[model samples]
Target: MTMTDNPPAVADGFVVRRSIDIAAGIDRVWAAVTQPDLIAQWFGDRCRLDSLEVGAGGAFGWDDAGDFPFRIEEFDPPRAIAYRWSNAVAGALDPLQVVDAHSTLFRFTLEERPGGTRLTVVETGFESHERPDAVVEDHRQGWTSELDELVALVEGAA
Candidate 1:
């Protein structure tokens, strides 16, 4: 339940991270994240996940921003899931198009907290991005608003 407090040095390391406590159980939070239908309610307008299998492919789309392709890098049921996605490009991205070091990886880590669940989304690998500032700013602000919506959706359902 204890994560490192230090943010990685900014020289070459870039990260946009956010953690929020939701007044819901882990299962509820997990469903909101992993299930495509529920993901659409919070994260993106369209969630196209092939499946929940670890290596499955997926895409999150916004009418204005375009589709971003991603592959499941890690899947651990209701506990965690990590997605490696192509952040720089939009629309019609192939799952295999993401180069390991070039693309960004965002992980959702869930921990049971008293009377609720603590969900943390940490996105790294921004240093490889052509416009790291734009990427960070986009996600930094996105996560803030997205997480607020997540809390509203999940807690409201409870």
Candidate 2:
């Protein structure tokens, strides 16, 4: 596994940001992230989406943690993508006062480096969570483990 100079940290109160450099090209990294088959290898146990375009609906399922539904907020090829999901009800989008209040948006940004690619995940909107501190900490640690798996898979393929 490669090393990350900067580990994930919560910033600006509501955002948790993390970045890792993978020993692979942008295309490979993009495929691993954007493709359902490849994402299952790292991000979740199973992934389902209506389509690849923005505003698509999907769910990431894990036997232990259950499935969480999400909406595609952005879809830019080989560069960036983002999803908004709400965990208030677990496995579904909660009917909160404001949709944005209880929903979290996670963005993936990929940049081509000379030897590989740098992938960053920034998840925000935790301030409105029932337990903001706990939720932030959970996801902050979650990203480390999830991306560790992603780096292993992508780098091993490279």
Winning model by TM-score: 2
Find the 10 residues in a row with the least total lDDT in model 2: 89-98
Task: Encode model 2's per-residue lDDT on 14-126: one tens digit a residue.
Answer: 78898888888999999988888888899879877778889888777777876777788999998999988765655345432215666899999999998899999999888
Looking at candidate 1, what is the lDDT of residue 95? 45
| lDDT for each residue of candidate 1 in 1-158, tens digit (9 for 90 to 100) | 33223222122247877778888899999999999999999887988988898889878888788877788999998899999888676653554465666588999999999988988888888887778888788788788778877888888888
**Once superposed on the true structure, which residue ranges of model 2 sit more than 4 Å away at CA?**
1-12, 89-100
Every candidate's CA RMSD: 5.3, 3.0
- Models 1 onward score TM values of 0.86, 0.88
